[model samples]
Target: MKNELLSLLNKNLLAVEPSLIRKFDDEISKIPGIIKLTLGEPYFNTPDHIKIAGIKAIIDNQTHYAPNRGIVELREAISEYLRRRHYAVSYDPQEQIIVTNGASEAISTAMNSFLGEGDMVLCPSPAFGLYRNLAKINGARYIEIDTEDDKYELTPEKLKTYLDEYHTSVKMLVLNYPNNPTGVSYSENEIKKLAEVLEEYPIVGECQEVCVNG
Candidate 1:
Protein backbone atom coordinates (compact mmCIF):
# COMPACT_ATOMS: atom_id res chain seq x y z
CA MET A 1 0.00 0.00 0.00
CA LYS A 2 2.83 2.40 0.84
CA ASN A 3 4.49 1.67 -2.50
CA GLU A 4 1.20 2.27 -4.34
CA LEU A 5 0.60 5.55 -2.51
CA LEU A 6 4.16 6.73 -3.25
CA SER A 7 3.69 6.00 -6.94
CA LEU A 8 0.51 8.08 -6.99
CA LEU A 9 2.20 11.18 -5.52
CA ASN A 10 2.71 14.20 -7.78
CA LYS A 11 5.79 13.66 -9.92
CA ASN A 12 7.00 17.22 -9.43
CA LEU A 13 6.77 16.85 -5.64
CA LEU A 14 8.55 13.54 -5.83
CA ALA A 15 11.53 15.31 -7.38
CA VAL A 16 11.64 17.87 -4.56
CA GLU A 17 13.78 17.12 -1.51
CA PRO A 18 13.17 17.96 2.14
CA SER A 19 14.30 21.41 3.29
CA LEU A 20 18.08 21.62 3.80
CA ILE A 21 17.61 24.27 6.47
CA ARG A 22 15.42 21.99 8.56
CA LYS A 23 17.79 19.08 8.09
CA PHE A 24 20.71 21.17 9.34
CA ASP A 25 18.64 22.32 12.31
CA ASP A 26 17.74 18.74 13.18
CA GLU A 27 21.38 17.62 13.09
CA ILE A 28 22.63 20.52 15.20
CA SER A 29 19.87 20.22 17.80
CA LYS A 30 21.13 16.80 18.92
CA ILE A 31 24.44 18.20 20.12
CA PRO A 32 24.57 19.23 23.78
CA GLY A 33 25.63 22.85 24.64
CA ILE A 34 25.77 23.78 20.96
CA ILE A 35 24.64 27.27 19.90
CA LYS A 36 22.46 27.10 16.82
CA LEU A 37 22.82 30.00 14.42
CA THR A 38 21.27 28.27 11.43
CA LEU A 39 17.61 28.37 10.23
CA GLY A 40 16.90 31.82 11.75
CA GLU A 41 15.53 30.18 14.86
CA PRO A 42 14.98 32.91 17.42
CA TYR A 43 17.39 32.83 20.37
CA PHE A 44 14.83 34.28 22.81
CA ASN A 45 11.44 33.16 24.02
CA THR A 46 8.13 34.94 23.34
CA PRO A 47 7.79 38.10 25.38
CA ASP A 48 5.71 37.88 28.56
CA HIS A 49 3.17 40.42 27.33
CA ILE A 50 2.52 38.49 24.11
CA LYS A 51 2.34 35.20 26.02
CA ILE A 52 -0.12 36.70 28.48
CA ALA A 53 -2.34 37.96 25.66
CA GLY A 54 -2.40 34.47 24.13
CA ILE A 55 -3.29 32.92 27.48
CA LYS A 56 -6.05 35.47 27.99
CA ALA A 57 -7.50 34.77 24.58
CA ILE A 58 -7.55 31.00 25.31
CA ILE A 59 -9.21 31.59 28.67
CA ASP A 60 -11.84 33.76 26.96
CA ASN A 61 -12.59 30.95 24.46
CA GLN A 62 -11.39 33.01 21.51
CA THR A 63 -9.99 29.88 19.86
CA HIS A 64 -12.34 29.50 16.95
CA TYR A 65 -10.91 29.21 13.45
CA ALA A 66 -10.23 32.63 11.99
CA PRO A 67 -11.49 33.96 8.66
CA ASN A 68 -9.80 32.46 5.64
CA ARG A 69 -7.85 35.68 5.14
CA GLY A 70 -7.26 35.83 8.91
CA ILE A 71 -9.00 37.80 11.68
CA VAL A 72 -10.43 41.13 10.51
CA GLU A 73 -8.69 43.07 13.26
CA LEU A 74 -5.33 41.47 12.53
CA ARG A 75 -5.74 42.19 8.84
CA GLU A 76 -6.63 45.79 9.62
CA ALA A 77 -3.50 46.11 11.75
CA ILE A 78 -1.40 44.69 8.88
CA SER A 79 -2.96 47.17 6.46
CA GLU A 80 -2.20 50.05 8.76
CA TYR A 81 1.36 48.82 9.28
CA LEU A 82 2.00 48.71 5.55
CA ARG A 83 0.57 52.18 5.03
CA ARG A 84 2.75 53.64 7.78
CA ARG A 85 6.04 51.82 7.22
CA HIS A 86 5.93 50.58 3.63
CA TYR A 87 6.19 53.70 1.47
CA ALA A 88 2.72 54.94 2.44
CA VAL A 89 0.97 52.46 0.17
CA SER A 90 -2.45 51.35 1.36
CA TYR A 91 -4.02 47.91 0.92
CA ASP A 92 -7.66 47.17 1.61
CA PRO A 93 -7.73 44.58 4.38
CA GLN A 94 -11.05 43.26 3.12
CA GLU A 95 -9.78 42.84 -0.42
CA GLN A 96 -5.96 42.70 -0.49
CA ILE A 97 -4.50 41.86 2.90
CA ILE A 98 -4.05 38.17 3.75
CA VAL A 99 -2.44 37.11 7.01
CA THR A 100 -0.52 33.94 6.32
CA ASN A 101 0.72 31.31 8.81
CA GLY A 102 4.22 32.53 8.10
CA ALA A 103 6.43 33.64 5.23
CA SER A 104 6.87 30.01 4.18
CA GLU A 105 3.11 29.53 3.67
CA ALA A 106 2.94 32.86 1.82
CA ILE A 107 5.73 31.81 -0.53
CA SER A 108 4.10 28.44 -1.23
CA THR A 109 0.73 30.09 -1.89
CA ALA A 110 2.21 32.65 -4.28
CA MET A 111 4.27 30.09 -6.20
CA ASN A 112 1.31 27.70 -6.56
CA SER A 113 -0.87 30.55 -7.76
CA PHE A 114 1.56 31.73 -10.46
CA LEU A 115 3.84 28.91 -11.50
CA GLY A 116 3.17 26.02 -13.89
CA GLU A 117 5.08 23.53 -16.03
CA GLY A 118 7.73 25.11 -18.28
CA ASP A 119 7.40 28.44 -16.47
CA MET A 120 10.61 29.98 -15.04
CA VAL A 121 11.29 31.43 -11.59
CA LEU A 122 14.30 33.79 -11.36
CA CYS A 123 16.11 34.04 -8.04
CA PRO A 124 19.36 35.59 -6.93
CA SER A 125 21.88 32.90 -5.98
CA PRO A 126 22.56 31.97 -2.33
CA ALA A 127 18.93 32.73 -1.48
CA PHE A 128 16.63 30.80 0.80
CA GLY A 129 16.62 27.17 -0.41
CA LEU A 130 12.82 27.05 -0.20
CA TYR A 131 12.53 29.20 -3.33
CA ARG A 132 14.18 26.55 -5.47
CA ASN A 133 12.28 23.68 -3.82
CA LEU A 134 8.91 25.40 -4.19
CA ALA A 135 9.54 26.20 -7.85
CA LYS A 136 10.46 22.58 -8.48
CA ILE A 137 7.35 21.35 -6.62
CA ASN A 138 5.17 23.62 -8.78
CA GLY A 139 6.82 22.27 -11.97
CA ALA A 140 8.53 25.58 -12.69
CA ARG A 141 12.17 25.90 -13.73
CA TYR A 142 14.25 27.77 -11.15
CA ILE A 143 17.11 29.88 -12.48
CA GLU A 144 19.67 31.43 -10.20
CA ILE A 145 21.08 34.84 -11.08
CA ASP A 146 24.69 34.61 -9.96
CA THR A 147 25.35 37.84 -8.05
CA GLU A 148 28.91 37.12 -6.93
CA ASP A 149 30.39 39.90 -9.11
CA ASP A 150 27.87 42.46 -7.83
CA LYS A 151 28.68 42.04 -4.12
CA TYR A 152 25.73 39.65 -3.70
CA GLU A 153 23.18 42.22 -4.87
CA LEU A 154 20.81 41.89 -7.82
CA THR A 155 21.33 44.93 -9.97
CA PRO A 156 19.05 46.25 -12.74
CA GLU A 157 21.64 45.51 -15.42
CA LYS A 158 21.94 41.90 -14.30
CA LEU A 159 18.18 41.49 -14.04
CA LYS A 160 17.60 43.07 -17.46
CA THR A 161 20.06 40.67 -19.04
CA TYR A 162 18.16 37.66 -17.67
CA LEU A 163 14.76 39.13 -18.58
CA ASP A 164 15.92 39.63 -22.14
CA GLU A 165 17.12 36.06 -22.32
CA TYR A 166 14.12 34.41 -20.61
CA HIS A 167 11.52 36.77 -22.13
CA THR A 168 7.87 35.78 -21.53
CA SER A 169 8.71 32.35 -20.08
CA VAL A 170 9.72 33.97 -16.78
CA LYS A 171 6.73 33.78 -14.44
CA MET A 172 8.19 34.93 -11.15
CA LEU A 173 11.23 36.66 -9.58
CA VAL A 174 12.07 35.77 -5.99
CA LEU A 175 13.70 38.75 -4.23
CA ASN A 176 14.78 37.90 -0.73
CA TYR A 177 16.16 40.95 1.06
CA PRO A 178 18.68 40.60 3.87
CA ASN A 179 19.07 37.37 1.98
CA ASN A 180 19.24 34.06 3.78
CA PRO A 181 22.77 32.63 4.23
CA THR A 182 24.35 35.74 2.68
CA GLY A 183 22.61 38.39 4.77
CA VAL A 184 22.85 40.92 1.96
CA SER A 185 20.18 43.54 1.29
CA TYR A 186 19.45 46.10 -1.41
CA SER A 187 19.55 49.81 -0.78
CA GLU A 188 16.66 52.17 -1.64
CA ASN A 189 18.43 53.35 -4.79
CA GLU A 190 19.27 49.81 -5.80
CA ILE A 191 15.63 48.75 -5.34
CA LYS A 192 14.35 51.66 -7.44
CA LYS A 193 16.65 50.76 -10.28
CA LEU A 194 15.54 47.13 -10.18
CA ALA A 195 11.88 48.20 -10.02
CA GLU A 196 12.34 50.28 -13.17
CA VAL A 197 13.53 47.23 -15.04
CA LEU A 198 10.75 45.06 -13.59
CA GLU A 199 8.08 47.55 -14.70
CA GLU A 200 8.66 46.52 -18.31
CA TYR A 201 8.03 42.83 -17.56
CA PRO A 202 4.81 41.02 -16.66
CA ILE A 203 6.48 38.62 -14.21
CA VAL A 204 5.37 38.34 -10.58
CA GLY A 205 7.84 39.50 -7.91
CA GLU A 206 7.83 37.46 -4.73
CA CYS A 207 9.60 39.82 -2.31
CA GLN A 208 10.65 37.89 0.80
CA GLU A 209 11.40 40.48 3.49
CA VAL A 210 11.16 38.32 6.59
CA CYS A 211 14.65 39.27 7.82
CA VAL A 212 14.37 42.98 7.10
CA ASN A 213 13.84 43.88 10.75
CA GLY A 214 16.77 41.78 11.88
Candidate 2:
Protein backbone atom coordinates (compact mmCIF):
# COMPACT_ATOMS: atom_id res chain seq x y z
CA MET A 1 0.00 0.00 0.00
CA LYS A 2 2.86 2.38 0.94
CA ASN A 3 4.66 1.60 -2.31
CA GLU A 4 1.42 2.19 -4.27
CA LEU A 5 0.86 5.51 -2.48
CA LEU A 6 4.46 6.55 -3.14
CA SER A 7 4.05 5.76 -6.83
CA LEU A 8 0.85 7.82 -6.99
CA LEU A 9 2.54 10.71 -5.20
CA ASN A 10 5.42 10.61 -7.62
CA LYS A 11 3.04 10.67 -10.52
CA ASN A 12 0.84 13.52 -9.22
CA LEU A 13 3.06 15.70 -7.11
CA LEU A 14 5.76 17.97 -8.51
CA ALA A 15 8.48 18.60 -5.98
CA VAL A 16 9.50 22.26 -5.52
CA GLU A 17 12.40 23.42 -3.40
CA PRO A 18 11.29 25.36 -0.34
CA SER A 19 12.05 29.07 0.16
CA LEU A 20 15.57 30.18 1.03
CA ILE A 21 14.02 32.49 3.64
CA ARG A 22 12.21 29.60 5.28
CA LYS A 23 15.33 27.44 5.09
CA PHE A 24 17.40 30.19 6.72
CA ASP A 25 14.76 30.75 9.39
CA ASP A 26 14.61 27.04 10.25
CA GLU A 27 18.39 26.84 10.63
CA ILE A 28 18.64 30.15 12.51
CA SER A 29 15.99 29.12 15.03
CA LYS A 30 18.16 26.15 16.08
CA ILE A 31 21.07 28.38 16.99
CA PRO A 32 20.86 29.53 20.61
CA GLY A 33 20.61 33.33 21.14
CA ILE A 34 20.80 34.05 17.43
CA ILE A 35 18.94 37.24 16.55
CA LYS A 36 17.47 36.70 13.12
CA LEU A 37 17.72 39.45 10.58
CA THR A 38 16.51 36.89 8.04
CA LEU A 39 12.71 36.78 7.86
CA GLY A 40 10.74 40.02 8.16
CA GLU A 41 8.13 39.49 10.83
CA PRO A 42 6.70 42.88 11.79
CA TYR A 43 7.85 43.66 15.29
CA PHE A 44 4.73 45.64 16.11
CA ASN A 45 1.45 43.89 16.75
CA THR A 46 -1.70 44.67 14.77
CA PRO A 47 -3.22 47.84 16.19
CA ASP A 48 -5.82 47.40 18.95
CA HIS A 49 -8.65 48.95 16.94
CA ILE A 50 -8.10 46.55 14.03
CA LYS A 51 -7.98 43.54 16.37
CA ILE A 52 -11.15 44.65 18.12
CA ALA A 53 -12.91 45.08 14.77
CA GLY A 54 -12.11 41.48 13.83
CA ILE A 55 -13.34 40.20 17.16
CA LYS A 56 -16.49 42.30 16.96
CA ALA A 57 -17.22 41.11 13.43
CA ILE A 58 -16.93 37.46 14.45
CA ILE A 59 -19.10 38.06 17.52
CA ASP A 60 -21.68 39.83 15.40
CA ASN A 61 -21.89 36.68 13.23
CA GLN A 62 -20.24 38.27 10.22
CA THR A 63 -18.59 34.94 9.54
CA HIS A 64 -20.28 33.99 6.31
CA TYR A 65 -18.24 33.70 3.14
CA ALA A 66 -17.28 37.01 1.58
CA PRO A 67 -17.20 37.86 -2.13
CA ASN A 68 -14.54 35.93 -4.04
CA ARG A 69 -12.72 39.23 -4.48
CA GLY A 70 -13.08 40.04 -0.77
CA ILE A 71 -15.39 42.25 1.27
CA VAL A 72 -16.31 45.42 -0.59
CA GLU A 73 -15.67 47.67 2.38
CA LEU A 74 -12.27 46.14 3.09
CA ARG A 75 -11.27 46.43 -0.54
CA GLU A 76 -12.31 50.04 -0.60
CA ALA A 77 -10.28 50.62 2.49
CA ILE A 78 -7.27 49.04 0.81
CA SER A 79 -7.83 51.16 -2.28
CA GLU A 80 -8.12 54.28 -0.23
CA TYR A 81 -5.11 53.31 1.81
CA LEU A 82 -2.99 52.90 -1.28
CA ARG A 83 -4.11 56.17 -2.83
CA ARG A 84 -3.81 58.11 0.42
CA ARG A 85 -0.45 56.69 1.44
CA HIS A 86 1.57 55.44 -1.45
CA TYR A 87 0.71 55.26 -5.14
CA ALA A 88 -1.47 57.42 -7.39
CA VAL A 89 -3.48 54.41 -8.53
CA SER A 90 -7.14 53.91 -7.75
CA TYR A 91 -9.05 50.63 -7.97
CA ASP A 92 -12.66 49.65 -8.03
CA PRO A 93 -13.34 47.77 -4.81
CA GLN A 94 -15.74 45.43 -6.59
CA GLU A 95 -13.59 44.69 -9.63
CA GLN A 96 -9.93 45.08 -8.77
CA ILE A 97 -9.38 43.96 -5.22
CA ILE A 98 -8.89 40.47 -3.85
CA VAL A 99 -7.72 40.14 -0.31
CA THR A 100 -5.87 37.04 0.81
CA ASN A 101 -4.83 35.89 4.29
CA GLY A 102 -1.61 37.88 4.10
CA ALA A 103 1.03 39.27 1.75
CA SER A 104 2.39 35.76 1.17
CA GLU A 105 -1.02 34.51 0.13
CA ALA A 106 -1.42 37.59 -2.08
CA ILE A 107 1.85 36.91 -3.92
CA SER A 108 1.05 33.21 -4.29
CA THR A 109 -2.39 33.98 -5.64
CA ALA A 110 -1.07 36.61 -8.06
CA MET A 111 1.54 34.19 -9.36
CA ASN A 112 -1.09 31.47 -9.75
CA SER A 113 -3.32 33.91 -11.60
CA PHE A 114 -0.66 35.25 -14.00
CA LEU A 115 1.65 32.29 -14.52
CA GLY A 116 1.45 28.79 -15.95
CA GLU A 117 3.87 26.12 -17.14
CA GLY A 118 6.73 27.56 -19.23
CA ASP A 119 5.83 31.15 -18.37
CA MET A 120 8.86 33.22 -17.41
CA VAL A 121 8.81 35.61 -14.43
CA LEU A 122 11.56 38.21 -14.09
CA CYS A 123 12.68 38.64 -10.50
CA PRO A 124 15.31 41.01 -9.11
CA SER A 125 18.00 38.82 -7.62
CA PRO A 126 19.22 38.79 -3.98
CA ALA A 127 15.52 39.41 -3.36
CA PHE A 128 13.27 38.28 -0.56
CA GLY A 129 13.59 34.67 -1.92
CA LEU A 130 9.89 33.86 -1.44
CA TYR A 131 9.05 35.31 -4.89
CA ARG A 132 11.20 32.62 -6.53
CA ASN A 133 9.35 29.90 -4.62
CA LEU A 134 5.99 31.38 -5.56
CA ALA A 135 6.94 31.41 -9.24
CA LYS A 136 8.24 27.82 -8.99
CA ILE A 137 5.05 26.60 -7.30
CA ASN A 138 3.07 27.85 -10.27
CA GLY A 139 5.30 25.79 -12.63
CA ALA A 140 6.73 29.07 -14.00
CA ARG A 141 10.37 29.77 -14.68
CA TYR A 142 12.08 32.44 -12.54
CA ILE A 143 14.47 34.59 -14.57
CA GLU A 144 16.48 36.51 -12.04
CA ILE A 145 17.89 39.89 -13.14
CA ASP A 146 20.83 40.88 -11.02
CA THR A 147 20.24 44.48 -9.83
CA GLU A 148 23.25 44.54 -7.52
CA ASP A 149 25.21 46.95 -9.66
CA ASP A 150 22.33 49.40 -9.85
CA LYS A 151 22.11 49.58 -6.05
CA TYR A 152 19.54 46.76 -6.20
CA GLU A 153 17.13 48.67 -8.39
CA LEU A 154 15.14 48.11 -11.56
CA THR A 155 16.71 50.72 -13.79
CA PRO A 156 15.23 51.73 -17.16
CA GLU A 157 18.31 50.39 -18.98
CA LYS A 158 18.00 47.09 -17.15
CA LEU A 159 14.31 46.80 -17.95
CA LYS A 160 15.02 47.72 -21.56
CA THR A 161 17.75 45.13 -21.82
CA TYR A 162 15.54 42.34 -20.45
CA LEU A 163 12.54 43.33 -22.55
CA ASP A 164 14.68 43.62 -25.69
CA GLU A 165 16.60 40.41 -25.07
CA TYR A 166 13.64 38.31 -23.96
CA HIS A 167 11.31 39.83 -26.60
CA THR A 168 7.67 39.48 -25.54
CA SER A 169 7.68 35.98 -23.96
CA VAL A 170 8.68 37.27 -20.52
CA LYS A 171 5.61 38.76 -18.92
CA MET A 172 6.08 39.24 -15.21
CA LEU A 173 8.72 41.32 -13.41
CA VAL A 174 8.93 41.63 -9.61
CA LEU A 175 10.64 44.41 -7.68
CA ASN A 176 11.37 45.05 -4.02
CA TYR A 177 12.19 48.34 -2.26
CA PRO A 178 13.27 49.46 1.22
CA ASN A 179 14.64 46.15 0.20
CA ASN A 180 15.39 43.25 2.43
CA PRO A 181 19.06 42.36 3.25
CA THR A 182 20.42 45.63 1.88
CA GLY A 183 17.78 48.06 3.22
CA VAL A 184 18.07 50.02 -0.05
CA SER A 185 15.18 52.14 -1.28
CA TYR A 186 14.29 54.16 -4.35
CA SER A 187 13.94 57.90 -4.05
CA GLU A 188 11.04 59.74 -5.71
CA ASN A 189 13.16 60.43 -8.80
CA GLU A 190 14.15 56.81 -9.10
CA ILE A 191 10.52 55.71 -8.70
CA LYS A 192 9.50 58.10 -11.48
CA LYS A 193 12.29 56.80 -13.70
CA LEU A 194 11.09 53.24 -13.28
CA ALA A 195 7.50 54.34 -13.84
CA GLU A 196 8.61 56.13 -17.02
CA VAL A 197 10.05 52.91 -18.39
CA LEU A 198 6.77 51.19 -17.62
CA GLU A 199 4.81 54.01 -19.22
CA GLU A 200 6.77 53.73 -22.47
CA TYR A 201 6.00 50.00 -22.81
CA PRO A 202 2.18 50.52 -22.98
CA ILE A 203 1.54 46.77 -22.84
CA VAL A 204 -1.54 47.22 -20.65
CA GLY A 205 -1.36 44.40 -18.09
CA GLU A 206 1.28 42.36 -19.87
CA CYS A 207 4.40 43.90 -18.28
CA GLN A 208 2.86 45.37 -15.16
CA GLU A 209 4.48 43.54 -12.28
CA VAL A 210 6.00 45.26 -9.28
CA CYS A 211 6.15 43.49 -5.94
CA VAL A 212 7.64 45.57 -3.16
CA ASN A 213 9.17 43.72 -0.20
CA GLY A 214 7.90 46.37 2.19
Candidate 3:
Protein backbone atom coordinates (compact mmCIF):
# COMPACT_ATOMS: atom_id res chain seq x y z
CA MET A 1 0.00 0.00 0.00
CA LYS A 2 2.82 2.47 0.85
CA ASN A 3 4.62 1.60 -2.39
CA GLU A 4 1.38 2.18 -4.37
CA LEU A 5 1.08 5.76 -3.11
CA LEU A 6 4.68 6.48 -4.08
CA SER A 7 4.13 4.95 -7.51
CA LEU A 8 1.07 7.11 -8.15
CA LEU A 9 2.87 10.35 -7.36
CA ASN A 10 4.84 12.12 -10.06
CA LYS A 11 8.62 12.33 -9.71
CA ASN A 12 8.40 16.07 -9.32
CA LEU A 13 6.48 15.57 -6.10
CA LEU A 14 9.80 14.76 -4.48
CA ALA A 15 11.02 18.29 -5.20
CA VAL A 16 7.95 19.94 -3.73
CA GLU A 17 7.68 20.81 -0.07
CA PRO A 18 5.00 22.14 2.26
CA SER A 19 4.34 25.87 2.07
CA LEU A 20 6.78 27.91 4.21
CA ILE A 21 3.94 29.90 5.78
CA ARG A 22 2.25 26.74 6.99
CA LYS A 23 5.50 25.65 8.61
CA PHE A 24 5.69 28.96 10.48
CA ASP A 25 2.00 28.78 11.31
CA ASP A 26 2.61 25.58 13.24
CA GLU A 27 5.22 27.30 15.44
CA ILE A 28 3.27 30.54 15.89
CA SER A 29 -0.08 28.93 16.61
CA LYS A 30 1.46 27.12 19.59
CA ILE A 31 2.82 30.31 21.16
CA PRO A 32 -0.41 30.72 23.21
CA GLY A 33 -0.58 34.51 22.63
CA ILE A 34 2.18 35.70 20.35
CA ILE A 35 1.50 38.44 17.82
CA LYS A 36 2.99 37.20 14.60
CA LEU A 37 3.93 39.43 11.70
CA THR A 38 5.85 36.60 10.07
CA LEU A 39 3.54 35.50 7.28
CA GLY A 40 1.24 37.98 5.54
CA GLU A 41 -1.92 36.25 6.71
CA PRO A 42 -4.84 38.64 6.63
CA TYR A 43 -6.57 39.29 9.95
CA PHE A 44 -9.91 40.30 8.49
CA ASN A 45 -12.68 37.96 7.49
CA THR A 46 -14.23 37.91 4.03
CA PRO A 47 -16.31 41.08 3.83
CA ASP A 48 -20.05 40.64 4.40
CA HIS A 49 -20.98 41.47 0.80
CA ILE A 50 -18.70 38.73 -0.53
CA LYS A 51 -19.94 36.25 2.08
CA ILE A 52 -23.53 36.97 1.12
CA ALA A 53 -22.74 36.41 -2.55
CA GLY A 54 -21.36 32.99 -1.70
CA ILE A 55 -24.53 32.25 0.25
CA LYS A 56 -26.70 33.42 -2.62
CA ALA A 57 -24.79 31.22 -5.04
CA ILE A 58 -25.42 28.22 -2.80
CA ILE A 59 -29.11 29.07 -2.54
CA ASP A 60 -29.36 29.51 -6.32
CA ASN A 61 -27.83 26.04 -6.85
CA GLN A 62 -24.63 27.39 -8.38
CA THR A 63 -22.82 24.45 -6.83
CA HIS A 64 -22.29 22.59 -10.06
CA TYR A 65 -18.73 22.23 -11.32
CA ALA A 66 -17.79 25.39 -13.17
CA PRO A 67 -15.70 25.44 -16.34
CA ASN A 68 -11.98 24.93 -15.85
CA ARG A 69 -11.43 28.66 -16.46
CA GLY A 70 -14.35 29.39 -14.13
CA ILE A 71 -17.91 30.67 -14.62
CA VAL A 72 -18.23 33.12 -17.50
CA GLU A 73 -20.29 35.62 -15.52
CA LEU A 74 -17.81 35.72 -12.65
CA ARG A 75 -14.87 36.00 -15.05
CA GLU A 76 -16.61 38.86 -16.87
CA ALA A 77 -17.17 40.62 -13.57
CA ILE A 78 -13.44 40.30 -12.85
CA SER A 79 -12.59 41.70 -16.30
CA GLU A 80 -14.79 44.74 -15.74
CA TYR A 81 -13.44 45.13 -12.23
CA LEU A 82 -9.84 45.22 -13.50
CA ARG A 83 -10.68 47.66 -16.30
CA ARG A 84 -12.62 49.97 -14.00
CA ARG A 85 -10.07 49.86 -11.20
CA HIS A 86 -6.64 49.25 -12.69
CA TYR A 87 -6.11 49.13 -16.45
CA ALA A 88 -7.58 51.52 -19.03
CA VAL A 89 -8.21 48.78 -21.57
CA SER A 90 -11.03 46.24 -21.67
CA TYR A 91 -10.64 42.49 -22.19
CA ASP A 92 -12.93 39.69 -23.22
CA PRO A 93 -13.57 37.63 -20.11
CA GLN A 94 -14.54 34.66 -22.27
CA GLU A 95 -11.21 34.77 -24.07
CA GLN A 96 -8.59 36.66 -22.03
CA ILE A 97 -9.52 36.13 -18.40
CA ILE A 98 -9.25 33.08 -16.20
CA VAL A 99 -10.68 32.87 -12.72
CA THR A 100 -8.44 30.82 -10.46
CA ASN A 101 -8.97 29.67 -6.91
CA GLY A 102 -6.94 32.67 -5.75
CA ALA A 103 -3.77 34.62 -6.53
CA SER A 104 -1.66 31.70 -5.32
CA GLU A 105 -3.16 29.29 -7.82
CA ALA A 106 -3.08 32.01 -10.47
CA ILE A 107 0.68 32.48 -10.07
CA SER A 108 1.35 28.77 -9.98
CA THR A 109 -0.80 28.16 -13.04
CA ALA A 110 0.71 31.03 -15.02
CA MET A 111 4.29 29.96 -14.26
CA ASN A 112 3.41 26.37 -15.07
CA SER A 113 1.78 27.40 -18.33
CA PHE A 114 4.79 29.43 -19.53
CA LEU A 115 7.84 28.01 -17.75
CA GLY A 116 9.59 24.68 -18.00
CA GLU A 117 12.75 23.07 -16.65
CA GLY A 118 15.85 25.32 -16.89
CA ASP A 119 13.76 28.48 -17.46
CA MET A 120 14.51 31.39 -15.12
CA VAL A 121 12.05 33.57 -13.20
CA LEU A 122 13.30 36.90 -11.89
CA CYS A 123 11.71 37.65 -8.53
CA PRO A 124 12.37 41.07 -7.00
CA SER A 125 13.24 40.67 -3.33
CA PRO A 126 11.98 40.50 -0.73
CA ALA A 127 9.07 38.78 -2.46
CA PHE A 128 6.14 36.79 -1.24
CA GLY A 129 7.61 33.42 -0.24
CA LEU A 130 5.01 31.73 -2.43
CA TYR A 131 6.63 33.11 -5.57
CA ARG A 132 9.99 31.54 -4.76
CA ASN A 133 8.32 28.27 -3.82
CA LEU A 134 6.21 28.31 -6.98
CA ALA A 135 9.30 28.55 -9.18
CA LYS A 136 10.97 25.64 -7.40
CA ILE A 137 7.87 23.46 -7.63
CA ASN A 138 7.47 24.20 -11.32
CA GLY A 139 11.13 23.33 -12.07
CA ALA A 140 12.12 26.90 -12.96
CA ARG A 141 15.10 28.66 -11.44
CA TYR A 142 14.24 31.67 -9.22
CA ILE A 143 16.59 34.65 -9.34
CA GLU A 144 16.09 37.29 -6.68
CA ILE A 145 16.90 40.93 -7.46
CA ASP A 146 17.70 43.05 -4.42
CA THR A 147 15.34 46.02 -4.63
CA GLU A 148 16.19 47.52 -1.26
CA ASP A 149 19.05 49.45 -2.82
CA ASP A 150 16.61 50.83 -5.40
CA LYS A 151 14.50 52.62 -2.79
CA TYR A 152 12.58 49.43 -2.06
CA GLU A 153 11.38 49.24 -5.64
CA LEU A 154 12.43 48.03 -9.06
CA THR A 155 13.45 50.97 -11.21
CA PRO A 156 14.11 50.92 -14.96
CA GLU A 157 17.86 51.21 -14.44
CA LYS A 158 17.83 48.38 -11.90
CA LEU A 159 15.81 46.20 -14.23
CA LYS A 160 18.16 46.83 -17.14
CA THR A 161 21.17 46.08 -14.97
CA TYR A 162 19.78 42.63 -14.20
CA LEU A 163 18.88 41.81 -17.81
CA ASP A 164 22.26 43.00 -18.98
CA GLU A 165 23.98 40.79 -16.43
CA TYR A 166 21.84 37.67 -16.70
CA HIS A 167 21.05 38.10 -20.38
CA THR A 168 18.50 35.43 -21.36
CA SER A 169 18.59 33.86 -17.91
CA VAL A 170 15.41 35.82 -17.15
CA LYS A 171 12.19 34.43 -18.59
CA MET A 172 9.80 36.50 -16.46
CA LEU A 173 10.06 39.39 -14.05
CA VAL A 174 7.60 39.07 -11.16
CA LEU A 175 6.24 42.46 -10.08
CA ASN A 176 4.10 43.09 -7.05
CA TYR A 177 2.77 46.44 -5.88
CA PRO A 178 2.02 47.49 -2.33
CA ASN A 179 4.76 44.93 -1.86
CA ASN A 180 4.42 42.32 0.86
CA PRO A 181 7.12 43.35 3.34
CA THR A 182 7.81 46.93 2.25
CA GLY A 183 4.25 48.15 1.49
CA VAL A 184 5.77 50.29 -1.28
CA SER A 185 3.69 51.27 -4.29
CA TYR A 186 4.92 52.20 -7.76
CA SER A 187 3.91 55.51 -9.32
CA GLU A 188 2.43 55.57 -12.83
CA ASN A 189 5.56 57.24 -14.17
CA GLU A 190 7.74 54.61 -12.56
CA ILE A 191 5.63 51.87 -14.15
CA LYS A 192 5.97 53.53 -17.53
CA LYS A 193 9.73 53.79 -17.19
CA LEU A 194 9.94 50.13 -16.29
CA ALA A 195 7.78 49.36 -19.27
CA GLU A 196 10.12 51.36 -21.45
CA VAL A 197 13.09 49.26 -20.32
CA LEU A 198 11.08 46.11 -20.95
CA GLU A 199 10.28 47.29 -24.47
CA GLU A 200 13.99 47.63 -25.24
CA TYR A 201 14.58 44.03 -24.21
CA PRO A 202 12.16 42.56 -26.70
CA ILE A 203 14.05 39.37 -26.05
CA VAL A 204 12.18 38.98 -22.75
CA GLY A 205 8.90 39.56 -24.61
CA GLU A 206 5.74 40.96 -23.01
CA CYS A 207 5.02 40.22 -19.38
CA GLN A 208 1.34 40.55 -18.53
CA GLU A 209 1.36 38.73 -15.21
CA VAL A 210 1.27 40.97 -12.18
CA CYS A 211 -0.23 40.43 -8.71
CA VAL A 212 -1.42 42.65 -5.88
CA ASN A 213 -2.94 42.05 -2.44
CA GLY A 214 -1.95 39.94 0.53
Strongest candidate by TM-score? 1
The collision pairs in model 3 are none
Please, what is the TM-score per model?
0.93, 0.80, 0.83
Clashes of each: 0, 0, 0
Q: For candidate 2, lDDT tens digit of each residue in 74-103?
A: 889989987788777787777777788877
User: After superposing candidate 3, which stretches have Cα over 4 Å from the reference?
Assistant: 1-13, 16-19, 202-214
In order, candidate lDDTs are 0.87, 0.70, 0.75
Q: Report the C-alpha lDDT of model 3 over 1-214, residue by residue, as the tens digit.
A: 9999988876655677787777888888899789888777788998999999999999999999999888998888888887898776687888788887767777777767666777787767886777776677677788888988777898788888888887676667778667877888888898888878877653333223443211
Q: How displaced is residue 78 in candidate 3, in Å? A: 1.7
lDDT for 114 in candidate 3 is 67
- lDDT tens per residue, model 1, 40-127: 8788999999999999999999999989999999999988988998868788899887888888998888888888999999999989
Q: Sort by lDDT, best first: what order?
A: 1, 3, 2
Output the lDDT of residue 32, model 3: 79
Model 2: how large is the Cα RMSD against the reference?
Answer: 3.9
Q: What shift in Å separates residue 107 of candidate 2 from its native position after superposition?
A: 1.2
